[model samples]
Every structure is written in C-alpha cells, then in structure tokens.
Target: MKTNEEKKALVKQQYSELALSADELKGKCCCGTKPMSPAKKVFTIMSEDYSKLKGYEADADLGVGCGLPTEYAGIKEGDTVIDLGSGAGNDCFIARAETGESGRIIGIDFSPQMIERARKNATKRGYTNVVFIEGDIEEMPVPDNTADVVVSNCVLNLLPEKDKIFNEIYRVLKHGGHFCISDVVLNGMFPKEFTDNASMYAGCIASAIQKEDYLSEIKKANFEDIKIERTKTVVIPDDVLKEHLDEETIEKYKKGNVGIYSITVTGKRP
Candidate 1:
C-alpha cells in the first residue's frame, strides 16, 4: 500500500493527467478499458434526452456528472448559463440545447486538456452559442453579474478552497441568479487519516463537506431557497473500491458513511 503522502501525490498526478486526457482516464476507471458501466448508463440516458432538442449532440463526450443541473435549474430558451468545472463540455452542451439558439452557455475549467476537449466537441457539433474557457472556478475570470444561471456537476468537492468558490459564484451571478449543482456530501466525520488521504480527496469521496456544513456555507454566501432535490446512496464499484480502500474502508462505505449522492441545490442571490 502507498503511504498517505504518496497516495495524495498519486491522486493529484492522476487527475492532472485526467484533466489533460479524459479518454485515458476513462480507461482507468473501475470498468476498465471502457466507460464505467454505471456512468455510461447515466450518460446514455442523458444524451438521448438531450438529442431531441435541435443543435444538441447526443454523443457529446464522457458522461461525468453526479446530478442533472439543467433540469433542476429550469433553463429556458434565452437564459445565459455558466457551468463550473465543465469536464469535456457534457453539461455545457446539454445546457446549450436547453438555452436554444437565442441563449448562450459558458463553461469554465482549470484543466487545459478538458478545455481543449470541450472546444473541439463544440466545434464538431457546430454550436456557435457555446464557449468554454480555461480558468479556475474559485477565481472565475468572467465579469460580475453576467450570468442568469450557474451550474456544476460533481466538481465542487475537489477544490481546496471551497469558500472562495462559493464567493466567486456569488460574485458573478446576477441578483437572483440561480446556483444549482450535484456533488458528494459526507454523512459523518471521517478519521483524520482518511480525511487527509489525497487519493480519497481526488476520487470525490474524502474531500466532501458534511451535509449540514455544505448548506450552511451556501447560506453564509448569501444564498436563499436552498433545497436538496434528490438523494441516493452511491455504491462504490467493486473494482475501484478494492484498488484504493481496505476492508475497514469498504465497510465504512457500505454502512453509508461514504456514498455517492446527487442533490439539486438551488439558491438565489439576494
């Protein structure tokens, strides 16, 4: 087994590579040499629904999301949308369709590779109204009060400075702009050792904020109308679970100490 520091380093390095090469990262997931079956199933369902709309690409890219923000955000034909941590433009593309030809979508990510992939996908699909930028969400490069809706998919938990992220999101949104996202949340406190594990952090499990703490942070950022739209227990796939976690860790996960959750949290800027 790797040391704690070593695990963290490895996870950071792996995600850096993933941000640069998502196809390669997909190969390394629990499913092996293909998209994780569960992820593929989810993506396929979303792609089919999105395809019905004009100018939408059913086969946009990897399906890397824990929640559906477009549905929850009530995206309309002329609304402006921003997607934080838009991996390979999946959510951005979907939002673009919902916004229609009159609407616009901006997707931002820190990973150059992800940005490149998103750009290429946008070009291939000929989506003139959609754009993706390479930048950090914690310090968004967009102008303040420019977006009508801001959404992210399972990406907030990966940040080291989450408060700044929320603040930035608040700053950019128009008054009464919407904030909707799907991310993991911890049910209880984790052991210090597990909490500090870098691998777990990047894997979207270890870095998750407690459920109550997450809601409180949103309120602290001056958001209102907070709601948890959906909650489902996420079962760690056997393959990836065995590779990173021990029996104790596995048991903890099985007991609902750690699980995948998809919540549609909606708040408006005051």
Candidate 2:
C-alpha cells in the first residue's frame, strides 16, 4: 500500500495532468466511466440544479462531483467562502454568485495545474473576488476564524486523512461558520476483492468508511447541527464491475456485502 504522502503526490499528479482537457477527463476518471455510462445514474438522485444558479464559466465543470454541496451551503452576500479542493472553480463560481460583489472567495486545491486553470477561468469572466490558490486542504494557508463558509464536492473522499481536513475546517471557520461538502461514504469497508484495486481508490471507493463513522468524525471535530442534506446510492453498473472483478466475486458482492452512497452533508462550528 502507498503511504499517505505518496498517495497525495499521486493524486496531485493525476488531477494536474487531467486538468489539460475536460473531454479526456470525463472519459478517463473514476473507474473509467464514460459519458452516458450507467455509472452516471448515481448522480441523478440528488444532482445539482446548476441551471437555477448563475456565473458559470465555460469548461469550468468537468462533471467530477457526485453531489452539489453548494446547493445547500446557504451562502449569503458578503460572506467569505472557502472552497476546499475547488477544481476548475466550478463550486467557487456558484458560491461567488451567492457571495456577490462585496464578498470574497478563496479556492484551494493541491493541484497546481488545476489552480492555473481556475485562475484563467476566473480572469475570463472578469471575476476579481475569486482567487484560486495551490494548497493542501488538510493544512491550508488560510487564517483561523476567517471563513464564513466552506464547501467541497466529491473531493474529500479521496483524502486519506479526513480528520485533519475536518479539523482544519473547524479551525479556519468563524465561530458561527459552517461547511457543506459532498462525498462518497460506504455502509461498510470494501472486501479484499475491491480494496486491492488502486483504480477504485482513485475513483472514491476504496477510501470510504461507514457513513456513521464519517458523521462521527465531523462531530468529533466540534461541528454541530450535522445533518445529511442529500443522499444517493451510486449503483456501479455490471459492465463497470466487469472491468474490475470476475463474475464470481461480483456475484458474491451482490449479496448485501457493501453499499456505496454519495452524500451532501452540512455542519456548523459551535
């Protein structure tokens, strides 16, 4: 198994390279699911209504998120929002509209290439308040008690040290500040059949623990009013599973062994 630092480096390299093209990214990422793939059905349950919101830049969304955390983030004008793992500034742009001209936004991602692309997109739309920075979410460059709100989507599940990320969120948020993030969580850990698959880890499968555990950690970090805003069972297609496991292993997995869910959860710093 790769160490945490190694995993972070690999994630950075992969996402940075994927930043080169949206078309290629959609087809190549997440256990190799293609556009119109059955795997996409997982998003239909609680998908983001991007049309209802405004300030979207072209090519900003590569459709990487499983749920739209920004949809329930409750951002207001003049609020300072921090977007963790903000890719291509998709959620950041949405948050920008809620924050309005008087507000500010800081989008932090470990991928330098993603930061470059996000900055370029922000500049294209003449967005002066949004700033994309290359930084680790677990150890952000942001100041303590600074952010009014924090948001992320589909990115937190990829991190190996989630407690650190949440702790950072707790520390950076103002006393009344809160976070709403979307991520994949499991009913149980994967069996050996899936745990050994590196591609699954990169696809946000192998890394997830139980949903209860996920919530408990957030509460442990001193976040209050924790609640799941939305949920969807991400059903992996038979065709997609065929790429990773044999028929026998797949059949065994079908017998109520594991369940993967995409959740948008909200919490407040008390």
Candidate 3:
C-alpha cells in the first residue's frame, strides 16, 4: 500500500502532466482517458458552468472546480483570501476582483507546474496582489489566522486525512474567518471495483467518503455555522460504471443508493 504522502504525490503528478495545457486537462475524465465534450459530460460530473460567472480567465478555469466557491465566498475589498487548491488561479482571479486594490489573494497548490502557470497568469494580467504558493494543503506555508476567507475547488476529496486539512484551514484563518469550498462526496463507499481502481481514486470518486462524514470532520475541527451552499449529484454514466464492473454487479449497484455528489459548503471558525 502506498503511504498517504505517496498517494498525494501521485495526485500531484497526474495533475502536473494534465496541467501542460487547458486542452489536455479538458480531455481528462476521472479514471478514464476520454475527451470531455457536451456529448460525454464526465467533466460535467465534477465541474460547474463558469460561463455565466464574471471575472473569468480562459487559462485559469482549466475546467476545474465543482462549484463556484468564490461566488459565495463573501470576499470584501482589502480582504486576504486563500485558495486551497488554487489550480491555475481560476478562483484566485475571481476572488481578486472581489478583494480589489488593497486586498490580497493567495493560491496554494502542491504542483510546481500549476504554481508556475498561475504566477504567469497573474503577470499576464498585471495583477501584483495575487500570489501563488507551492505547498501541500495539510501543511500549508502560511501564517496563523492571516486569511479572512479560505476557498478550494474539487480538490480536498483526494486527500487521505481530511481532518488535518480542516485543522489547517482553521489554523490559517483569522478568528471569525469563513471558508467556501467545493468537492465531491460519497453517499457510501461505492463498489470495491471502483475503490480499488487507481484511476477512480485519482479521478475523484474512489477517494471520496460519505458526505456526512466529510462534514462531521469539519465540525470535529471546531468550525461552526457550517452549511451547504450548493449541492448537485454527479451522474456517472452506465458506460463509465461498466468500465469497472460486470453487468450483474452494475445492476446490483443500481438497486442500491450509491451516489457521488458535488457540494460547496461555507463554514466559520468562531
């Protein structure tokens, strides 16, 4: 078995290769290597429609994120905002518009390529206040209680020890600080076929735990006023399921309540 740190390294490597280009990232589906298109819609499973949102930068979106956490982040001018899995600075740029002149935005990502790309994007747009940091989420290189808001997008579910992440989130935010995050969650562990599949784990489904359990971890870390800001079911098609299960097993799973859902939640540390 791989160590938790090893697993995280794998996740970072997968994303680094995919980060080579937006077109390459768009072609990726969780465990499967299929191009995302309107007809396929697997990216649709975990990504939100960003066309309607303002302050969009083409390179930053990268087709990442399950929900628009920045839209609900309640970022004020001059606020300090930290994005957990900044990924090309999609949310950071949006948060930048909200934070305005005196505000500062920091995006943390373990992938060196992602951090470089985000920094380049900031320069291309001449944004001096936005900074991208290369570091792991469980152990962020940030000061205590410095951020007014923390945000992430479809990234936390991949981590093994989520409670550590919550603690880190709590540690980085100032008192009365809040977080808006989007990620996938399980209704229950899906078939062993999926959980056992390496691709599935890297894709965002296999690593997911029950939604309630995820939230309970947040509460355990001493967050309050935790609430789901948005939620939607992730529809994995029959074809996708078939890639990992037999017809009999697939039918059996259908009869059960196994589901993957994407949710954006906001919580406060009081």
Most accurate candidate by TM-score: 3
Q: Rate the local accuracy (lDDT) of all candidates.
A: 0.71, 0.81, 0.83
lDDT accuracy of residue 72 in candidate 1 = 84
Give per-residue lDDT, candidate 2, residue 178. 95
Candidate 2 to native Cα RMSD, angstroms: 3.8
TM-score for each prediction? Answer: 0.81, 0.89, 0.90
Clashing pairs in 2: none
**Candidate 1 lDDT, tens digit per residue, 1-270?**
456445434544545565564554343455565645432232222221344544445344454566666678888889999999886787887787788889989999876767877888999878899999978787899999989999998778767567888899899999988888887787765655566655556667666787888888888888888888777565556655555667786666566554345566888888
What's the CA RMSD for each of the models?
4.7, 3.8, 3.6
Ranking by lDDT: 3, 2, 1
Candidate 3 local lDDT, 66-128, one digit each (tens): 888998899999999999989888999989889897999999999999998899999999999
Runs in model 3 deviating more than 4 A are 25-44, 243-249
TM-score-best of 2 and 3: 3
Whole-structure CA lDDT of model 1: 0.71
List model 2 lDDT by residue over 175-224, tens digit each.
99999999989986466777656556656666677899899889889889
In model 1, pairs of residues that clash are none
**What is candidate 3's local distance difference test score?**
0.83
